[model samples]
Target chain A: MLIVGGGVVGASIAYGLAEEGAKIGILDAEDSDFSASRGNFGMISISNKGFNNLAYFRLSYASSRLWPEFASTLREQTGIDPAFDLKGKVYISVGDREFAAHAEKVAEYARRVGAEYQHDILNRADLRQMLGNVRLGERVTGGSFSPLDGIAEPLKLYSGLLNAIQRHGGSILRDHRVGRIQHQRGIFTVEGPWGSLSAPRLVIAAGLGTPDLASQVGISVKVRPQRGQMMVTERVEQSFPYPVSGLLRQNPEGTIMIGVSTEEVGYDDRTTVSVLRSLAMKAIERLPDLGSVQITRCWAALRPRTEDGYPVYQESHERPGAFVITCHSGITLAALHKRLLPQWILGGRKDALLEPFGLGRLQSASAA
Target chain B: MRPPHDLPEPPHQVSFRFGDEEIEAWEGETVATALLASGVMITGVRAMSGRSRGPYCLIGVCHECLVEIDGLANQRACITTVRQNMKVCRQTRLRPLTGEDETREQ
Candidate 1:
């Protein structure tokens, strides 16, 4: 088995397969590339993950459920704790009306998909007690919480998966950028500067590199770069018990994380003062006390976004056993890649339902 | 959390630094303490444009304390903790571009 791109998604998948008694080889990338795993906010995001797509919601929920066990398993195996926190994810709202509308959306989607939804409402006073040092705004209403949603440090998770998979007999070829993937007859070949790999089954999890690899065959993907900028604060003790929705997560370290503005910046992962200031001030309005807290880091990373900003799981029509899996929420889906995806990779039953998530959706959506 | 602003104490860890100094912090410790403890509040960068910046918003929400670490420039110093002897440098202070491009000859 061959896996391209050794970030959290690929590493987790490779680790899962290797642990499950499958031979796995990973071709990692060079340092300069935009690794969502390195700069990801690490939210096991489930709140409005697939607001328009129900399949995404289901896939995200499954990954969320498998998070704790998967995190612990990797921790136990590699002694690298990804800091799985599930106090809950809260989505602050503009007003009660907005809250109700979002709640209605989730509730309606839950009923439609037969998935249970959980949430609560809180006023200013209620909110203050919840955020230890946070100062709440008067207009700020409460948010929705999902037991199945949480966060982890994406970098830690990526590194852990890399180590654990390697420990479990998976080979990782870091700093090797894959240039081409050619398939002939029943064999799939992956070529790069360092070397080339030939296998019956080939898996491409390279964030933005998937299209180039897929196009080598007859498959094409609509995957595009969606850059997100995030600001990290100096560690403040327990900034928030649980992560807040809208891409704000308080890491285990004492610091409030503000971030993750999604933009179509064409792979330019550079931060700007206007956007950074806006994000900081917006977060401060809700938690005014953070005004004095010192911000420590601000950076941007390109999200491997499909046109609709969701995951794409595809098997090439021209090349059998050739698959491409890409998503902006690599951290959130890390668990699924570990626990479930190995089956699909091993020539096991393919879940046809995932077909809706393929790049073909981008074409149809564009046409519509 | 309906407002997301409300939340009890959650646990976490991270490092903070000011210039060459650094400190260990908890999930609840703001970057201010981390910087003050290490005594790194001065800056060579004079904020060529906006107001002078420093550690303000230990909660990663503010850009006041942004610094450059590793080769990646413009990192929020207050939001990130001092991890693995991270090589941190101050943001570019307007010292007039001195690179090869500045000496443009026909």
Candidate 2:
């Protein structure tokens, strides 16, 4: 098996395939390329995922479920503890209208899919009791919580996944860019700067680079980049749990991380005073104690986004045994890729759950 | 034949450009960081508000720092370093997705 783009997605898929007894080799792009996995919010999040896309939701849920076992196993094998925290999570709304609308949105989505969505809304008093020392904005009504949600150490997980993949008999060739790909007689050939590599199957998972590569194999992802910025504060005392996103997350490291502002600025990932100040100020508002907290580092990353903001998974209608999977929420769905994609990769079975993600809706049937 | 001993270089690097504007940047630095280090505050303007939004998070998580590089629009310049002779442009608009152009319905 040949996997291109050896980031988290590439590594995980390769490891999963290897676990299923496939000879897997991953060809990763140059590290300098725009990568998202290393800079994730560390959340195996579900709130950011909507119910309209059932494939994405199911995949995210499956991955969320597998995180506990996955992290433990990887840590044992690679000695890289990802700090996987499955303490449930919340997303707060500032106004009543937004809160009601969001509640209705997820509720209807849950009913449509017949999935038991127990995310609930709590008033300020109830919220205060659940999370002490959180100061809500004047119009801030409350938030929604999903017991299925969790967070992890993104960099550690990325490193651990790569290490575990290596130990599990998978080879990841980094800094080698695949220049082109060709297929003949049920074998795929990926030509990189080093040389030509052939495998029975190929997977492209280079984060933002997935779209152009899919086109090379007669497939299209319609994937794009959306910029996001987040700040990490200095390590402090562990104050709260259950990622206080849209406000803050008191990480296992005891640092209060906060303020993830999303912008659709093609791919600029620079931090500015205006943005950094606003993010820091907002974080301080949520936790008054954070006013004096020092920010250790600030960063911006590009999210791999689809036109409709949903993941795209496809087996080439034109080329058999070749698969392409792309998603904006990699952390939320990493577990699913490790557990599920391996089956599809091996048995050549078109998963029913992912049928809706085919490319027939956008590209020609040949590309789907 | 010509030397200005009375003046310093003002400490600048012109190794990159965004559109017609010269985005002063340094070697071995990501486009985003180089832009910030040069005091270039705002990135692309918002689609709805058209107001200037600078880099919020230095990482690619917030999607606040996306700029066009070469012909590629929406490349995350934070992780993308400023190679010599690279082109960077701030992308500032919204495009709707057509059903015929995608596999899944948006």
> DockQ of each candidate's interface versus the true one?
0.02, 0.02
> What DockQ would candidate 1 receive versus the native complex?
0.02
Q: Which window of ten consecutive residues has the lowest lDDT sum in model 2 chain A?
A: A359-368
TM-score of model number 1 = 0.74
- Candidate 2: stretches off by over 4 Å: A95-110, A113-115, A133-139, A363-368, B1-106
What digit string (tens of lDDT, one per residue) describes model 1 on residues B1-106? 0112345744445555445555555544444445555566743253434455677666656556666655344456665544644566666542111121222221
> C-alpha displacement of A70 in model 2, angstroms?
2.4
For model 1, the stretches where C-alpha displacement exceeds 4 angstroms are A95-115, A352-355, A359-368, B1-106
Q: Write the per-residue lDDT of candidate 1 for residues A130-234, one digit (tens) a residue.
A: 666655666677655566678788778877888898888889887888898877889988887888889898888888887888777666777788878889865
For model 2, what is the error of residue A174's alpha carbon versus the real structure, in angstroms, after optimal superposition?
1.4
lDDT (Cα, tens digit) per residue for candidate 2, span A1-368: 88888777777787778877888788877766778775577788865466666666776776787888888877888899888888887666666797788778767766765654556667667666676554555666777777778888888888888888878788888777987888899889988678888988898887788777788778866777777787876444455556776557876535667767777778787767887788876665554555655466788877788777777777777787788888777877777778778888788665676677667656443423
Give the C-alpha miss distance for residue A266 in model 2, angstroms.
Answer: 1.4
TM per candidate: 0.74, 0.73
Using DockQ, give the best candidate's number.
Answer: 1
